[model samples]
Target: MRLSRSFLPTLKENPAEAQITSHRLMLRAGLIRQTSAGIYAWLPAGLKVLRNIANIVRAEQDAIGAQEMLMPTLQSSELWKRSGRYDAYGPEMLRIRDRHERDLLYGPTNEEMVTDLFGQVVKSYRELPQVLYHVQWKFRDEVRPRFGVMRGREFYMKDAYSFDVDYDAAVDSYRRMMLAYLRTFQRLGVKAIPMVADTGPIGGELSHEFLVLAPTGESGVFFDGAFEEQDWLSEAVDISDRESLAKFFARMTSFYAATDEKHDEAQWAKVPPERRREGRGIEVGHIFHFGRKYTESMDISVSGPDGAPLYPEMGSYGIGVSRLVAAIIEASHDEQGIIWPQSVAPFAAVIINLKNGDAQCDEICERLYAAAPEHLLYDDRGERAGVKFADADLMGHPWQVIVGPRGAKAGIVEVKNRASGERSEMPVDAVLAHIGVGA
Candidate 1:
């Protein structure tokens, strides 16, 4: 993508409406624009990051046996009514009436709808276990929507529902989903620890929220630093083996992690004082083992082996797909701008043409750009070297390939790691190798 031709509308100053670091940086970096109160239109760069996050969430979900499907943003109010929550959901739900005066709503969550759909199709214990998920836009009428996409009124989300034969089976599903969330966040290049959380409107007795630690986070947290030492992605766990799942669950819970709301001094003291870490955290994902809350409320049931009707034990897992963009920025940005994780960066690297009009500089940049045209952003704009450098840093690509006339002429370019601020002079031929791209 050529900067001169791209629709990136970066700003020199932050927008007045943006209060949080992520919101302010997102506006100035041209990643998103506010279209309405608490709503945004994701620009090219922002949408790329959004899709990358969603794809990782999808892949992790699929790996855990969850099947993906699309669900409507608008749902019939009848589903909520049958579950006895239509009136109780409050102002956050955007209730509407169609031409026939039939009631409808923009779904804030899909527990009731999913329960009804599952009951309509599955009738017996044979198909007792299933995990279904969808990545879609959701609307919630926040009285005061703030913090950019972090607390947006309309945002993208990935919600999955699991149905099982009984409480024990449902618990297994919850553990598997937790493992998936850990793997998902690890791959996305963020440290999100699971903490005990209230179910709230989701109405579950067992719940956990994944919080990404950040200095500017909303919730104060106390945790054991051991969480940083464990690599979830490389940990081997057999999803089908209940004993393995239980051991994994036990190990995760063994860590002392909690938000201020649920903090326990007794538990905190149990950790080695030196290994204890206190910080602020932003909630990015949540999982709940609600058992028969929805199934019983909606009267959804399956026939047991004994021919008796049994309400399926269930669980709900959610990841704020769009909010993660802001969360990642909140956790990773520095004074210059966002230092994007390679997995979710809009571009793998930006090729900054320090002398855009110079033939030798253009030749070197074009060569690097062509090596992976789709993954590279070529700054071919006729802007000053300062503007190009600032924009490259602001956009926060993992790497910046500098092509100045002097270096270009020598067939050597300077490569800088965005996160480390480390620069290396490399042969033009070695640029792709340094950035982990195939020649």
Candidate 2:
């Protein structure tokens, strides 16, 4: 991607409306643009990051045996009505009417719809345990939507529904998702503490919210420091075995972590002083085991092994895909701009041509771009070196390969680490090796 030819519209000054670091940096770095109060137009660079985050979320969910599928954004109001929530959901539910005067709604969540669909397909306990998920756009009418994507009216979300024949099986499904969420955030380079949280409108007996710590987070959170050392992917869990699943669930739940709403002073005191970690946090994901809440309300039933009618216990897991873009920025940005993790970085690196018109500089830049053009952003614009450096820092490329006239002539280039600000001049081949790029 050539900088001059790209559609990136970076701002020189911060927008007055951006009250948070992620919001300001997102705008200044040309990642997103506000189309309305809380709705945004994800530009090319922004969309790339969005897709990368979604892909990671998808992969983690898939690893846990969740099947990916597509769910519509618009839904029948009748579905909510069947679940006894159409009226209860209130103003946040965007109610509408089709040309035929039938009631419709922009779905905020898919609980009722998924319940109805699953009930129609699976009639017996043999299909008891099933998990389905989708990455889709959702709309909820917030009275005062603010803080960029964090509290937006329209957002991208990954919602998964799990159905099981009984309570124990349903709990196992919830714990599996909790493990998946930990691994997902670990890969994304964020520390998201799993905190006990309220079920709210989802109406569940058990719930956990994955919150990423940031100075400007909306929720106050407390957790044990042991959460910091967990390697979720490496921790082996035998989900097929009931005892193993129970043990895994115990390990995850042993930590003292809770949001403000669920914080218990007596329980919090039990944690050793040295192990206590307190901070404000932004919720990135949530998992709920609501049992037969939806199934009972919607009259969804399946036959047991004995041919007895039974309501499948259910759980719902959600990851705010679009909001994570903002949450990641909040958790990992410096004053310059966003410090993106390699797993979800839009581009692996950016090559800045200090002398764009100079033959030597252009040759080096083009060569690097040719190696992996899709993963590299080349600054070929007629801009000042300072401007190029500033923009590269603001955009938060992991590595910046600088090709000035002097280094280009010497068949060498300067490579700078975006996070560490470490600079080194090396042979072009060495530069390629350092950036993990090649011919």
Candidate 3:
């Protein structure tokens, strides 16, 4: 993508309304533009990053045997009513009325709707274990929606529901999901630890909220540093093997981790004093087993092996897809701009033509673009070298391959690592090799 032809309307100064680092950088970087109090129109650059994040979430969900399907943003209120939560969900639920005067809502969550979907199908124990997920926009009318996408009223979310015939089977499914979460966060280049969350009514130690640590986060978090040393991807844990899943889950949960709400002073002391660590964090994902809360409330029953009605044990897992964009920036940015992790970066590297019209500079950039156009963003705009450099750093492409007249004439480029602020001058092909692009 050529910056000269792109729609990245980056701001030289930060927006006054953006009070947080993620919010300010997102505005300055032109990732998102606020249309209303909390609503945003994701610009070209923002949409790409958002999609990249969503794809990663999708892949990990698929890895855990969860099937993907699309669900409606505007859900029928009737489903909520059947579960007796239509009135109880409170103001966060964006209630509305259609032409027929039927009460409706822009779904805050999909538990009721998904439960209804499950009840309509899966009539027997043979269909006992199933997982369904969807990535879609959701709305919650936050009384004070601030902090940009981090606390937006409208956001993209991935919610998955699991159905099982019994409590034991449901717990096994939860462990598998937890393993998936750990692996997903690792790939996304963030340190996320699952903390015990408040399971309101149906409870027995089956709730967890995955919090990504950041300096400016809202919630206080305490966890063992052992979480940082484990490599989830390299662990030989098979999802289908219940024993493997149990061991993996135990390793993660055994660490003393808790958010402010569930913080236990006695438990904190129990953790080895040397391993105790604390920080503020943003909630990125959460998974909880609700047993038969929804299935029983909605009277969703399937025939058991003994031919009697059995309410399926249920759980809901959520990842704030849009919120993650802000969260990643929150956790990774420096004074200059956002330092995007390569996996979720919009483009792997940006080739900055320091002198756009210069034949040598243009030739090298165009050649680099032609070699790996999909992974490269060519800064073809007629701007100053400083402007290009600042913008490149602001957008946080993992690498910046600079083509100046001096290096261009010599058929070489200066490759700058965005994260490290390290620079090395090398041949064009060597630059490509360093960034892992085939020439």
Could you tell me every candidate's TM-score relative to the true structure?
0.97, 0.97, 0.97
Q: Rank the candidates by lDDT, best first.
A: 1, 2, 3
Q: By how many angstroms RMSD does model 2 differ from the true structure?
A: 1.3
* Per-residue lDDT of 155 in model 3: 96
If candidate 3 were superposed on the true structure by all CA atoms, what would the RMSD be? 1.5
- Give me candidate 3's TM-score against the actual structure: 0.97
| Stretches of candidate 1 exceeding 4 Å from the true structure | none
lDDT of each: 0.92, 0.90, 0.89
Listed per candidate, the RMSD to the true structure in angstroms reads: 1.3, 1.3, 1.5
How does model 1 score by TM-score? 0.97
Worst 10-residue lDDT window, candidate 2: 430-439
Could you tell which candidate, 1 or 3, scores higher by lDDT?
Answer: 1
Candidate 1 achieves a global lDDT of 0.92
Residue 268 lDDT (model 2): 95
Model 2 lDDT tens row, 1-439? 9888999999989899999999999999999999998899999999999999999999999998999988899999888988999999889989989999999999999999889989879999998699999999999999999989889999999999999989988988998888889888888888888899999999989999999999889999989898778765576887677787788878778888999999999999999999998989999999999999999999999998888889999999999999999999998778888788877888889999988789988888888889888889999899898999899989998899999998789899998888888999998777666877665
List clashing residue pairs in candidate 3: none
Where in model 2 is the C-alpha error above 4 Å? 437-439
